[model samples]
Target chain A: MADFSTDAARALAGPVWLSDRRAYAAAEFASMPPPDATDEEWRYSAIQEFDLSEFALLSDVRGAEATPSGMGDNVLGDAGAVIRTANGRISSIEVDDELAAAGVYVGPLAASGQGSAQLGAVSADATDYFTVLNDAFAVEPLLIHVPAGVVLRKPIVVTHHLSGNRGAAFPRLVVHVGADAQAEVLDYHTSAQGSLLACPVTELDVASAGRLSYLNVQQLGTETWQFSSHLARAERDASLTASTAAFGGGYARTRSDVRLVGRGANCDLLALYFGDGNQGLDFRTYQDHVAPDTTSNLLYKGVVSDAARSIYTGLIRVRPEARGTNAFQTNRNLKLGDKAWVESVPNLEIENNDVRCSHASAVGPVDTEQQFYLESRGVRSSEAERLIVAGFLEEVLESLPVAAVRETLRHQIDAKLSQHVEHVEHVELDELVENTELGGG
Target chain B: MSTLVIEGLRARVGGQDILKGVDLSMASGEVHAVMGPNGSGKSTLAYVLAGHPNFEVLGGSVRLDDLELLDLPAWERAQAGLFLAMQYPTEVPGVALRDLLRVSVSTSNDASEIEAAMRQEAKRIGFGEKFLERSLNVDLSGGEMKRNETLQLGVLRPRFAIIDEIDSGLDFDALRMVSARVEAATKEHNMGALVITHYSRVFEQLKPDTVHVFYGGRIQQTGGADLAQELEDTGYRRWSNENG
Candidate 1:
């Protein structure tokens, strides 16, 4: 266990321009104690089990030539720009010259200088212990900026690869879509086999009438633990679509907050997660409507098998002044094994009488009728189960804006399903068949 | 030469007996119709033959050719050359009709031969190319669903098929269209079929070789196609009263 000190935080902040922000964040972190299970935000979480002292901050790996390997044919071919990060350090960035000349910037946050205030803004408002730690220790933060009225035809992709033992990697990404600009961004987090801690923060600011589509994929090693926070704000008439697909980590927790701060702003939140083995995946979401006529919709679906567990809690809040707001939240889970478990809670807090808000949640095993239907068509039992699970997740995946990423996610899910078939207790067809006969209409 | 033989078959659902000692046989190149009142256990018999998990076969033997089907699972029975056109097909979200057909057809046929067969079947059933891309049974009309089931029967090309209430919700044209497709495919494959229906309209097109009056969970009488017309005109009153 390594004790994270102010000096250590300063040492981890390699760029001189970012030292002041790091010192402030480090002082804040040192002043406050870590949160425990008693905190409302940490309810149902394994916060008491997480010990920050077990990991050390990742040090500067400047000039290190560790390029991302095996990215090969799977890389996004239609991406206008691709940024690769190795151990919290930017290793390579490729951008189309035409887009770059049109004021589309992709580079390290330290290069943004004073313009990087937005990078710290997200962590400053709701400063958690991990957010403060990430603020103080992030080696090199990535920044994506699109100028006013610029519409990039191709998406921008960022891949973070963490490969170290018992070390903490703090990765930060800040995106700004100027007024009336349209863009798509994808963030992929992957790690090698190791007992590492990953703390990442992302901030997205969509200006008036801007449209931004963002996707985040977490595929850390099974031995790793990850805590991620994503904050997004949309201005008047702006639209924001944010999605997540989580598939890895021993204990992965993500908190997403979307604020529709201006009139007529709209936001869509989507997520699909599958956990196998002894993994635990937790998610918390907040949809805040601050201005009139703002709308938000959230849909999250997951499947857990082989003693894996999942937790989902979401809140939709409509302020008093935010009249005519429409909001919806839904969470669905499928437990593929007898020992697998899931807990889902959806709530609505409305302060206005004119707003329309609804929330729904369900947690159950696979539908027997569906399974029987597939088997009757000559599909093997296991193959039938796989198809049902895949179909369960296809709704969320198909909603994604990127076709390429959707296909990749489907393939990854198929791989996971194939590898863990043994862990799933095959439903005894004979017993089900016998039981089914008694209920025939 | 193959036949689907059901002898002295008795079954129950939810601890209550539904089919009591049903006996029937349909050889290849023959189409049989089973007609009775609403509760005559026509659908129950069809489900039992399809190995429906809910329909328990208490005592009986079912065989297709030389294969004993009563002990096999639903999928194995399907692989053994039996098919069931469900009265009410289940809706499968996110599974496309094309994908479902591909999987079902590949069970007994080669993958290379699937596309052409699927296209031909889809066209034969009046389903356009876009219909094949939609989710299985999702938002489809009653006629479309029945046609889709017939399409499945055509694609799989089973040696024997059980059509349960295939004319229940169809309009006049839809019923004729679906029956024509089923008849064409059955004739093309020389397949044995047991068509369950209350109306004699479908029998008019199928021209079944045998018609059995079913009541009280068993076959009451057997005759030619005239029996279906007789039951349709006179109703199942005679058979129901006799069973009582």
Candidate 2:
């Protein structure tokens, strides 16, 4: 309806050399209609309110060279490589010589032409409006490939920064860990304060006996709207631990689909989201177990305060052929304000009787027992509540692979807590104090 | 003289009176044991003193060294040198024991001295480094939880302490170990204590200066340490039947 045709896709692709891929994806996007609230996948989302015609797909920015403010430093400390993109265009790429000598490729996806295979591999199975749109217009895609048996000691950090207003950006990243390889990758998304749209897609392919640790930190501007999709596939004996920290964005939604396709493959999915001040944070996850003895554990925790809202719906599906699969899904939400709302739905679809699957969900305020416990230890009521909330989120934060990034996320959570405490009423000391003249003298 | 004074304290849970007109007083460096049968308001007294919201104080006056504790919040009372070793210490997930101890001690002591004292006290309580790093009271044994509470007492060194049922659910050796630590803390800080228990065994290890028999939410009788042995031999049936 918004006229995202082949010619427009070419224009949005800018000077990128992936014309054929862009054209093919553009034709696909043109044939498919935009998702509405009626679609099962788009339920409980503000998809009906989304107007693709409101924002322009700008291929260039004026201040693309300037480093955006609030971009975290040393996010991937001691990284083997760093690739940065601004306004959907590659700004810089650097790789360690030792890693490069071991056949590790870290550079632009379009330049190497290695991303097309994995790029559409995931979205092809279950296409979404945003994924098709991203495939059609993603100008500069980043790639990180760790070759067979190459165990890189350091991670590969990728930063995507948006700088202009009233524009839409499509950022893509493809990660491939070869057989017996191990690696970690971190992606940071930040932008200047303005109304913008960001649709980012990340695809991870873990080969047999490979291990990958991936982290996505979304710190977009307060006025920005982000819709991100992440897909990961783990092969035989492969393990994938994918985590996300969503702190910023006016209306942010992330859908992650992880598939364990081979025997004994394992995946652990962890996510933390905090929304404040009329914001909305939504997440939909699918853990598809297709092979025997495969396991997936998912834990997602979030806090909503002010007039903010959050929704989490996750499903763990065990196929009929997948016996002896052990899968667990947990989603916990803390509503700090009376007006704040959260909806958590954890579902299990197990076709195999031999599989073990359990799902748990909770949405409520902080535990009063935890609050009183802290208050009894000389912590003030406000500080006590803060400590409880922090402690509630600490498990996921500490599980982060990078200490520096974890520290940064902790600081962000603290800042949000401080701001939230100002607008809410905590347990009062005067109220708890006993009256002196109630009983007879 | 520094003292903890509770005069005509009355409290109720959900409109049912639990601590009815309770009176107690103890000076610094004094150890007083309160033995009572189940449902006699022993734990309620400790919780009301700690400002637990579940217990509504109908009327009371609690003071520690001229500071009116009844008018203060739990944290303020704690800041004014009052401590409570709960009968059931809450299980706070993701909060390490070391972190809780550091914060609790820093409220009344120097920040720089917390880590060293924390490590020392943790080791003194037979807690390994891993135990100190584990979540507070999570997956801890009954004895370990009691020891952790005693460790907090050592860290805070309050002017007064209320330990409720610290000896319950502990084996003989664990009971001895925990009682020894509680005794050491009270003596080292020169603090007054109100030890609430159902058994006289803990009093034997603590060697309390006084023992009080509690029934019907009030102290029915008060006597020297021998009272503990008398109650142990006779049981609480005598006082409970008289009060009922």
Candidate 3:
């Protein structure tokens, strides 16, 4: 649609950097192009979802207020320091000034008015087009930096809300966990009821012996579209735990790119999505191990209903230098409607023979026997389906590190499911929704 | 008479005929046992009678208290007073037993007071109030889950129950507990019960008034608990051919 990446790049280049590292990173992001489905990495996922051709590069500061969506009274404080961003601009910021006192970096990218040069040094190869697109048209990237060896008891939560029709916004985030430092980042991406498009790219680096746990909550409205790219790096003895819960969006695609470049680094990538109505949810993942003795585990689950569909493709690449890498990947889909479809492909390219890797993918409807048992116990078919689907998604939600985020994810899923199921024609599932064949090779 | 009548019932599963023109009936005060060998369609009969979708009714019909059994969904059939205590009850992970019972009770239009009473009845059947709050059959021991199912059968108190192999995986004590609950559910509650099993030990505990030997997909003989004992000694091997 619009080529604002250039203008966006030029704008980011002038920002202040904590050091030379960020400025160089901004330069790298400026030179990259958005990826499309023609690219090998974007095959299974429809890169067309990112085609914000009919969307506006919303610069206007006009939008409705965003109602806080968390459970009860402000649980966002523990996400270290929390902030709320609405209509692509920062409206509220909560920072633990003490962490700032000890030289900690926690603020919005726009607030700092600094940090391009320092961010530049650590940027990886435009891993995918979305990342490049994000880098090009980036805005308000949440800025978070934990100084060396500081263990914050509370996690920092960031809420970004998208509103408006035919309007698209690019979100950017830069997080650097210092050596021997442990930090948690809670990111909530939301959209209003009107149709809007959001393209976001997040860059995270876990320094040696530093632990990073990143959670993304994407609960957009049925009219919005989403293109989110997440890139993470784990250094020697560094561990990264990341989870993405997708409960909203009309058509959404998420790319989780992880690089285990440090010796003995570990990464756990988890995702859960509930697609109802006509929503098409897609996930593209890459676990690239470039060093020896690295370990990675991935678990992704989805509940598809109405005529919704989802595609999940995960690749684990063990370079020749990356020996003794233990990798595991699994994707399980529970279809609430007979016509709901899920496609999953787990790829393993092992250049090193001393590695162990296994992957599995399964797509099926609720067990008929199980349904009968519950129904005979006097539960109606719809209520029974709800119980089974909730239980199905709970498996992944139960493992989330943060209780607040987990509960929000669960509630969002239930809300979406209830709306979708209301229109689901139980008696005519086969006729109302068509099952789309998924998986390539 | 409180009765569940199966008249000339023919059922099919995956295009294979399982229950071939099977006919039987049970009164409120009587437990009728359908004893059969493996592959004799004993369980299939039970499931079809309970409206399992996998089992298609190819011919004939089933009527419980003059209400057409084939005319309702599984849940409706249940609300109409039918219960099937399965051989292998499916475990629903993360579901609390009490939650499931409460939902079932609510769906049946049972008043809140009656629902609470059902919970008490389930508790009396063996499950402690604490255990009832746990997830329905989630990670439960085989025996514990089975007891929970029996507890459900007791609380539900159907007019017609197709209890298939309810004693298969139980020890002596568990079996007695099960039979006692079934007795209380039927004898005291005036429920017509169909107890399907291969072993007669369940009959010894539940005391069925009539026993039918099912072989080759049909009832070969109908008699009393004495018939169950006689077949227990001579297996259905020879009778299967004669009946066929």
Candidate 4:
């Protein structure tokens, strides 16, 4: 943590409250040791290989010319507001005039005048090593606040782009939906091709009777490492939909915690991830039902090809006060390569006897019957496999809360499949070349 | 007219000899009925012709005109104008029927042509348009699954179609409707059909040009349409292995 020291944290320009908060968080981060694979929370993860010393905080002196373009190209045709950040610093932000008139704010958290009061309101209890690092070093945290009774028909898009070799970006975002308000947000993460680290933390707070839909799409470079945290809380009668579509990263992990604090509150957690090359995609989720009649459902589907791997461990905890709760968790994985791997663990801890809970998980190659069925209809073997894989992931992808980017994500998955085929062809070509040379010799 | 010739076809499944030296040949625009009792290897012959992976072909040669079908994979066999209407159609949960038809149709890039053909066939077979949007054969009733097979046969219009036990799970009305569609498709497309069934009720709607008594994994007798009525009346007792 030498590069992420107290001096570095203090040197970051911000308001007095942000400075004080970062200083305290830097002290906490300094005292805490790096996470080990032996820790229960880090089980089956690549934590042992994670070296914090290899990365330095991104420099603040990067000029506008240094900022690469196309990172914030809004695929969503309809957006109420747009915010673009480069290397964890806000480069530009634009809020629709009508949305602004309705008391919607989308800009730097420190300059929004709300200050640090709601920054850590939902994620304060997070003790994860990467989350604490994000707390200490997040340079330009943004806030999207919607006023009570306001309904945003379009989404709010926030794009974070990381650049420079070995440069780390800690992007922090807080979404606050006021009482009876309805809104949707899309958090896009992309980076240049280099050895980079992204530790992002997002806090979602939905007031009583409010509704919020948040989708996090992480498509970083294959050489980058990412550890993201999403902390969401729903009040009485409020509904929250949190979805993630993760496709890129050398070793990416996301830990999500959703707490239903008020009665009649419910939440749906969905994720769609496809890993290729030597990538490792890991996920941990916790659904906490605190009040009576609260409900939660989680569905996560993933595909691993080449030598890639994935891990999914989720838990549903229903307290005694949460009587009549209904919770369901499902994790399905498809392994396309012989060496690909997956670990799916779904647990339930029920302190109430009146709850209905169920869990399901499956890990295997593409179904032979499905393959034969498609192939029997004139589809080639490779095309049959691609179709089955796409169909296997369509369950979760189609249910994504953000509809505008669903097709783009589907195309991305198809592109990954095509690249897998190309990689195999290249390997075969290399073997052929070697054979030819040996024969000539 | 094209010919589908099967010579000395010997195959096994799970280490058991199911198809032991079967011989049959049919010309395009002709309908052949292979009637057999249970475990007579009628289905095995259909699967072997279509190149199912589980069944090991001990020795056989299937030719669709000049194309050697046995050496090809199932999809290649299909591309060579072979189709199998499975008895128990496999359910694909997330892939829609229209999508499957769109890809399986050879003229794939012409989307409207395929869509129009599928909808017309679906209507002829009494299949609802909504079923096209649903997952392929998922949660469909037995009759609906049969109709779905008939619908695909109508749209794909292969050179040869092996209808395996298509009349088993169908009710009387459904059987009549499905068989009528198959009959219409075979005549309209000049498709050679091997309609395998244990019963002759389905023939009321679909008239076979030639009927062959299949027993011991070989054709014991071949005759005209009256042969099916004779087997229906005699119950295949003379052809039974125990009786023989």
What TM-score does each of the candidates earn? Answer: 0.94, 0.94, 0.88, 0.94
Error of 2 at A17 (Å): 8.3
Q: Model 4: DockQ against the native?
A: 0.71
Candidate 1 lDDT over A1-441, as tens digits, reads: 685677776775456657777877888888988888898778877788888888877664553234333333445688889888888988889999988999898988778653556686655665688888888888888899998999988989898888767878989999999899999998889887878899999988899999999999888888888999888999999999989999999899998899999999999999999999889999999999999999999999999988898999999999999999999999999998789989898988999999989999999987877877777877767777888889999999999866567777887898889876644444456667778998894
RMSD of 3: 5.3
Number of clashing pairs per prediction, in order: 8, 0, 32, 0
lDDT of 3 by residue, A315-370 (tens): 99999999999999999998776778888888999999999999999899987877
Which regions of candidate 2 fall more than 4 Å away from where they truly are?
Answer: A1-3, A12-17, A64-72, A425-441, B106-109
Question: Model 1 lDDT vs. the true structure?
Answer: 0.85
Clashes of 2: 0
Which ten-residue region of model 1 chain B has the weakest summed lDDT?
B103-112
DockQ of each: 0.64, 0.70, 0.62, 0.71
Each model's fnat?
Answer: 0.56, 0.61, 0.59, 0.59
User: Which one is best on lDDT?
Assistant: 4
Error of 2 at A132 (Å): 0.4
Q: After superposition, how far is residue B61 of candidate 2 from its true place, in Å?
A: 2.4
| Tens-digit lDDT string for candidate 4 (B1-244) | 8999999999999999988788899999888999999989998888888888999999978999998899999999998888999998888877888888888877546999889988999899889999989888888999999999888888888999999999988899899999998888778888988999999988998899999899988888999999999998888888774537
Steric clash count of candidate 1:
8
Instruction: Write model 4 residue lDDT over A294-411, tens digit each, in one string.
Output: 9899999999999999999999999989998999999999998799989999999999999999999999998988888888888787777888888888988888876887877887
* Model 3 misplacement above 4 A: A1-8, A12-34, A48-56, A62-74, A77-80, A96-104, A109-123, A336-339, A425-441, B107-139
Please state every model's RMSD to the true fold in angstroms: 4.1, 3.6, 5.3, 2.7
